[model samples]
Target: MNALARPFSVAAEARLSSADLPKPETLIRIEDLTKVYDPKEGPVLDGISLAIGKGDIHGIIGRSGAGKSTLVRCLNGLVAPTSGRVLVSGREISSLSGAPLRAARRDISMIFQHFSLLSSRTAAGNVALPLEVAGVEKNEIRRRIPELLELVGLSAKVDAYPSELSGGQKQRIGIARALALNPQVLLSDEATSALDPETTEQILALLKDINRRLGLTIVLITHEMDVVRQIASHVTVLEHGKLVESGPTFDVLAFPKSQVARSFLSSIVAHDLPRQVSERLRPSPAPGSSPVLRIVFAGQAAHEPVLAALVEQFRIRPNILHGRIDYIDDKPLGVLTLVAAGGTPTLPGVLAYLSSLGLHGEIVGHVL
Candidate 1:
């Protein structure tokens, strides 16, 4: 199996537990953050409050016009909030001005959706621009450029100009430039949206590796659910500039509470039944109909032979209509939609049994 699929094949005991994570440190805190460009248009960010722990790959996801871009800009001090505070490393970013704000931004670096490299500058020169702007000596710039290039696995492309590199290579250069100052927080604003699927995975893997090596706290801003599923330890959902849901990625994915969140996760997880299946479903059980159950298996329950147990213990045959199994942060999460024949009379006992196994079982509908 490939490296990505390997995680799904591993035993549940090998899964990383929440206790294995580092102790919480409030690295970035946003309290009641609101940003309004025009009085009549309403706030772009509406009373947002959140805390990002140190050494976390946190994803903030929303659709277009969801204020995702505005929020990231606020985090980096590019746009001042109308009401509320943005604190990074215990400094109030919204309160700072001019030189202090400029200096404060050194600790918070950002990579853009577009690889914002100068057309004339080579990879090494682009990486050196930040150091130069900070007034570092030429000798220091010379020494730092190669190290940054090497960190992003682009040391050999030091002399290649932006025009000469592919999209992925240009992104590597962009990542190198973002890390030039060794910032405390890295804001990725749709950094992988421009790349192909294969290249996106490569970039995400690289980012996860960087997070592991440097203990860097990353705020990933994007609309892609797969991006959050692949790398983010924690996820926050935004809709119409409001904070809808936020929590550990596995928990959110396995048991989403909001409509928007469920919609976003539907692509990766079977949050809703297929349209054709739904059309066939009835609200109440008919004479020859079977009850369709939606079962959610998370953590240890994912590896258990629950389906076999249902057949053996309850003497019910399960016909799977739709199902998907996915790993989030190396832990298995699965959702199965199946019809339980001859299980209507024993439904209560089956639900209790499933609950005993720490699984969620719900009767969605009945279908003949």
Candidate 2:
């Protein structure tokens, strides 16, 4: 979806208050996490480790076959790990089994991309299922369902069956059901992937609200960078069953020290261009023109006037072919590609000045 098509309202961009967020300094921890498909195929998750602070909205992202799903499955014992421990709120949950395992799981909740609610059951009935299994009184289930439905904005549809709801509505039902047991943590696996962009935003908003209202720690796995940027306070990037990077979303995104970080940088920075337009960009190797440079301007450097100063001072011309600015936690990071032309002797000075201004320029290739 085009970003300009769905701009945030002034109120929405101000940031919801943080007073209600969780304080679970270490609500969930994956220690030396490793999951192997078998002795034949080898380790699918390799020595991964991370921590989720209390009430933090942590996001895990990776491409298909990156072992993100495998890691999450091991957390709740849905998929057991070959080795290592998963401690939820400081209790080792990965090795638990039988009734103990079931009890541990009650403190954790997971939501799916597909609406896993029963088709014949009403939304209320479906939300009540988890409680029923736990042997909660029927009265308590009835009392809780309405509040849960209202929380996700699904109160009006409580009596409706799954077929009667839209994709987003169905997901809200899933969210309410997952919250049925009032677990300390919430797990969402690609929960908004199937929804439309507008619907996706709504659901994300709901999750953020839930995280705040309930002080619940959330760990979600997604392929969409937009999802990660939207609400994840911290993010872990995975690739080929290995953790490429993990840290606070704003921190990792601001510095982007790894290849995975570079991949995300490319996505957020280049997403603004039409694919065909981007294909037309390149460094020309012809004789006369200056270099085609890719400059990464992070944090405060995003607003520096280095280019203008260089062009005016050196009597050079710069054609800004493409540019984008993305924010993590309301601070901007910028990427700009330009065709630089000037006196050959001034190139080094210009590059040095750009560096001084906090923007790093790479002479990708010569432009004709």
Candidate 3:
């Protein structure tokens, strides 16, 4: 067996309990927020409540027309909520207007899906625009531009124009421009959607590096689960402008409770069995049928030899139908679908053994 397939010692299990960790400070809070564009169309954001912790890479995921764009607009005061409040750093963003709102927005900045850089401006000029608009002195703007470019690893491209730079480089310029105001929170609206897969991974890595180096809070809005799985520490699911699920990324990905979430995660994790395997499944057991088991391996359990144990201890032969292991936020998450032949009589004991090892096991169906 490989190192990852080795059995772990149950006595050495050391999962961290929630009570053991200090709670993170809340940087953004949405309380019963709603936005109505037209009475006939109903609210775009319906009674949504969510809290984003300081220094967290929070991901908001949903299908198109799910109100993701509307919620983000409400956060930075671009769109006012019909009712309820949005608090950022203890100040109500939903209520601010005019000069107050613009000033408050300095603490919150945004980047877009398209590289919103001016075609006429160079990389340094683009990064300097925000500072110039804020009325910072020429000397201060000159001093800050180099630092921002260096932060995004684009010092060499200082003189490059948007047309001259690649897509990833343009996004680096956009990110640097967003940070020009030294905002406390950064909002990304489908920032990586337009990039190719390799470029998307690079952009996500840059975002993760920025988050760690500067301790800046990031609110990432995307339709891709792989994007969230790559960097988000916390995740929230929205459906029809309502909050369907919210929690730590690992927990939500390991055992999703909502159908929308499950569907979204299908690409990242095996939420459904293969069509061939599923077609063979029967709701009830037959004379020579065997129980199909779906096992979820997470944390320490991902490295355990649970399948070997089934064969050794229970004499259960496992015919693995489908399985895959993926890492989320640097931790393992694995799902396996298998036929537990000759194990039906010991189903209860098999589940109990899995439970003792901190794994999730369910009898999905029977197959002959």
lDDT of each: 0.92, 0.81, 0.92
Give lDDT tens digits, candidate 3, residues 36-57: 9999999889999999999999
Tell me which residue pairs clash in candidate 2. Answer: 24-54, 286-368, 289-368
Q: Which stretches of candidate 2 lie over 4 Å from their true place?
A: 1-24, 254-267, 271-289, 313-315
For model 1 the local lDDT of residue 59 reads: 97
**Which residue pairs clash in candidate 1?**
none
lDDT of 1 at 98: 95
What is every candidate's alpha-carbon RMSD to the true fold?
Answer: 2.3, 4.9, 3.2
Which residue runs of candidate 3 sit more than 4 Å off their true CA positions?
A: 1-17
Put down candidate 1 lDDT per residue, 208-327, tens digits, no spaces: 999999999999999999999999999999999999999988899999999999999989989899998999999999998899999999887787899999999998899999999998
Error of 1 at 318 (Å): 0.9
In candidate 1 the C-alpha lDDT for residue 79 amounts to 96
